[model samples]
Each structure stands twice: as structure tokens, then as C-alpha cells.
Target: MTLDFSVVTGAWQSLLLGTVGTLFLAFSGMALAMIIGVLGVVILRMQLRLPSLLVNAFIEIVRNTPFLVQIFFLFFALPLAGIRLNPTLTAILALGVNGGAYAIEIIRGGVESVPKGQTEAGLALGLHKHEVFRLIVLKPALRAIYPSLSSQFILLTLTTAICTSISAYELTSVGQRIEAETFRSFEVYFTLTGIYLVISLVTMWLLAAIGRRAFSYPQR
Candidate 1:
């Protein structure tokens, strides 16, 4: 059968709307994840043993489970237990929690990569532990993990398609809707794949640029 561009062309507005939703969900989720990750990393690195154990348990649970199951539990099961989140909120929260676990590992690795000598040097200079971590460690650690972090964000963006499973009307959902309405499965899905690919590539480039600008001093 000859390929039809008509179905794709016809769904332009719907696709654009879906793209906006996808971007919103992905970036918002990443932002929330970043906040949780920073706090979790600090907690995990605490001198106290209990804090480390609690943080590790949180990371282990989130990293071990499938994100889809997590989303289902948050969206479906929570409501049954009286915590009713709307679809978009559920998607954001699920993605944030899942991504935050992964970010914790990345951020922790970055933290550990900083030289022991640097911490000692900072201490000798009379810098407090928190001051040393904030000024000497965190920025360099972020620089060390910059590539990994950017890649993770990109992956998170693509994973936002899973929101469609919970009926969040993201890009994938738009494609599904178009296919249902037009009965042009191949055309609709092919267009979707290309659209998502373009979106992901662009996001990667944007993140790379941001990392370059933000982490420039670390290279010196």
C-alpha cells in the first residue's frame, strides 16, 4: 500500500497540542525530580547512619520497581485510598519520583568522584563541612555528571509517552487518537515516531548547550 501523508497532515493541530503536553509533563517532572534528587543526595551523604539507610531504602525501592507499576499505583490505587490526583498531576508525580531515584545515584556518583584531598584542603582552610560541600564539591560533581544527567533528562522526556497509558493525552495519545479516528495506523504511528525522535534530539541539544554554559568554569 502506498504511504499516505494525509493522516499526518490532517492531525497537525492535535499533534502540536500533544507535543506541548508531552514537553510540559517531561520538563515539569524533571524539575521536580531534580529538587527531590538534590535533597535526597544530601540526606544520603549525611554523617548519621539512619538518614543514609532511609535514603538508600527510598532509592532502592524506586529504582527496583518498574515506572509503569509506580504510575498505576499512584494514579489508580491512591484514589481508592482517598488520595485522588488528576491525570496530569499523577503523571508528573510518578515520573518525578521514578526519575529522582535514578538522579540520586547519578548525583551521588558525582559527589564521590570529588577528590578526598579537596575536602581536606577545604577543611584546612577552615571551611565548614556544609560550606566545602556547597562550594567545592557540588558544582564540580555536577560538572562530572553533566553528560549523564542530560542523557537521563532526555530519556525521561521520551518516557513521558507512558503517560498516555494513564490517559494523560500526551503525544502518543494524540497519535493513538488520530489512528482511531482515521483508521490510518501506519501513517499515524510513523509520524508519531518521527515527531518523538525530533523532539528528543532537540531536547538533547538544548540540554547540551545548557550544560556547556553552566559548567564552563569546571573545565578550566
Candidate 2:
């Protein structure tokens, strides 16, 4: 038997909107994760036991728990505590918090990769500790770990589909609605699978380009 993809043309608009929503969710999440990762690394590098323990706890909690549950907690459970977040904001927070936990570890590895000599040199050269870490260590470390960070970001993008479970109205949700209206389950999901693939490919490409530009250095 042949497939009937005639429904796609009709569902096109919704799919496009859903795609935008998905991209917004993924990008916002990754950006917030980057902030958290950078700050977390700095805190960890300070070697302050209490702060490090707290950061570690945050990472372990997010990493060990289910992401879907995290999103639900933000969207549904928070209201019980007299704090309410809109679906989009909750989705971003969930994705960001989850991705950030992993990002912290990955970035900490990067920071540790820097030679101890460099840190010593910066300190001897009259730089403040924070300045030394930021200028002499963090940048090069980030460059070294760019590939791992990019991969993590891609994984974070794929996780955007989970946002649909909380009614964040991303691509997966759109596909589900389309399937209900058109009664074409296979077609809906098959198309969504392809769409996700394309989305990931484009995201990877963009990340690569940004990495090259942001991390590139002049030849010695």
C-alpha cells in the first residue's frame, strides 16, 4: 500500500508555527544553561567547599531526576506553592535547568583541562584570581571543550519535544493535534521525525559556525 501525505499541505502552517516554538524553547534553554554552566564552573574552581557542594547537589538532583517530571513540577506543582509560570517560561526553565546540570560538569572538565602553569603565571603577573580564571583559563578551556558543549547543546535541543507534554505547544504537540484532526497517526509522526532530524541538523550547523567564529584564534 502507498502512503497518503496529502494532509501535510493542510497541516503545514501549524507545523511551521510549532517549529518556531521548538526552536525558541531549545535556544532559550541552551542560553540559560550556558550562563549557569559558566557561573557554576567559576564557583567550583574557587574550591570553596560549601558552594561546591551546593552546586554539586543541584547538578546531581537535575541529572538524576526525569526531565518530564521536572517540567511538570515547574508548570503544575509550582502553582501549589503560590508561584505560577506560564507554559513557555516553565518549558524554558525545565530545559535550562536540566541542560545546565550537565553543562556544569562538562565545563568543569574544560576548566580543569587548563594547565596549572597558566593559572600560576596569571597570578604571578598581578592579575586578580577572577581575572586570571576568566582571561587565562576560561576562554581556552571553553575552546578545548567546544565540541563536547556543542554535543550537549544538540542533545538539549532534542529534549525540546518533552516540552509538549506540558502543553508548551512545540513541534510534537502540533503533530499530535494534527494527527487527531486528520486521523493520520503514522503520517503525522513520520513527518515529525523528519522535521526533528532537519531541526537538529540545522542547529548543529549553526552551533558549529558559531564555535568557529567565537573560539577561533589568530595563527601564531
Candidate 3:
């Protein structure tokens, strides 16, 4: 089909609105994931076997399963078990929890890569475990793995499209609505594809800047 300017204009409008929803879902999910990731990494660093095993198991399960299935389970199945959440809230919770699991593994790897000698030296200097981890381990781990963490966050942004399945009205869902209205599937979706690409690029750039600023000392 020939590219229709009218269709492009209308679809682009809808896509812009959908982008708001997309941003909300993606950023909120990442925020929650950050909390989960930090906690998981700290627990793993406790060197407790059971905590390590539990965290690892959660990571594997979330990473291995399809995100769509996880979303569906949280949205549909939980209500049957006496817990109910609105669609948007359920979508965010599901995505956040799943993304958090991946973040845990990534952050845990960074924590593990910290030098044993560094911990020993801190202890010899009479530092507490928490003090050592906060001052020495956390910064180094963040610096070493910031690139990986940023990539995961980017992936999480794209994963927001899964929210469409639950009618979350994110960017992809907006494109779907436009396609249905105008029957210009190609124009509708390709426009959205470009929008998503731009959003992802800008997000990664911002994340790189933040990582550099926050982790500057570690680089030195």
C-alpha cells in the first residue's frame, strides 16, 4: 500500500499519547527493579547459602519464562486466589518483578567480581561488613557492570510492549488501536517502530550519562 500522509498524521498523534503510557510502564518497572536488584545483590553478598540459592532460583525462573506468561498469571490467576489488582497495576507489578529477577543476577555477578583482598583489607582496618560493602564493593561492582545493567534496563523498556496484551495502551497498543481504526497497519506500526527506536536510543544515552556521573569515582 502507498504511504498515506493522512494516516501517518493521525497514527502519529495516537502514538505520542501511547508513548506516555509506555514511558510510565518502562520507567516505573525499572525503578522497582532497581530496588529489587540492590536488595538481591546485598543479600547474595551475605554469603548465606540459602539466600543465594533462593535468589538464584528466582532469577532463573524469571529469565527463563516468557514475560507474557508471567503477566497473564499475575493478572488473571491471582484474582482467582483472592488477590486482585487493576490491569495497569498488575501489568507494572508483573513486569517489575520479572525484570527485578534479571537485575538481581546481573548485580550479583558484579558483586561477586569484587576482589576478595579488598574485603580482607577492609576487615583488617576494622570496618564492618556493611561499611566495607557500601564503600568498597558497591561502587566497584556498579562501575564494572553499569554497561550490562543499562542494557538490561533498555531491554526492559522494550518489554513494555508486553503490556499491550493486557490492554495497557502503551505505544504498541496505541499502534494497534490506530491500525484497527484506519486499517493502515503498515503506516501505523512502522511509525511506532521509529518512535520506539528513538525513545530507546535517547534512554540509553541518558542512562550512560547518569552512570558516568554517579560512578565517576570508581572509574578513577
Task: List, residue by residue over 1-220, the lDDT tens digit for candidate 3.
Answer: 5787578685566667888889998888888998889998887867799998998888888888999999998889889999988877887888789889988888888888999999999999999999999888888998998999899888988999989898886888888887888888888777888888999999999999998798887444
* Candidate with the larger TM-score of 2 and 3: 2
Model 3, runs deviating above 4 Å: 11-13, 218-220
The lowest-lDDT stretch of 10 consecutive residues in candidate 2 is 1-10
Better of 1 and 2 by TM-score: 2
User: Ten residues in a row with the worst lDDT in model 1?
Assistant: 211-220
Q: What TM-score would each prediction reach against the true structure?
A: 0.93, 0.95, 0.91
Candidate 3 similarity to native, TM-score: 0.91
The residue-by-residue lDDT of candidate 2 on 49-87, one tens digit each, is 999999999999999999998998788788999988888
Q: Candidate 1: where are CA atoms >4 Å away?
A: 218-220
lDDT of each: 0.91, 0.90, 0.86
TM-score, structure 1 vs. true: 0.93
Q: How many clashes would you count in candidate 3?
A: 0
- Candidate 2 wrong stretches, greater than 4 Å: none
- Write down the RMSD of all candidates, one decimal each: 1.7, 1.4, 2.0
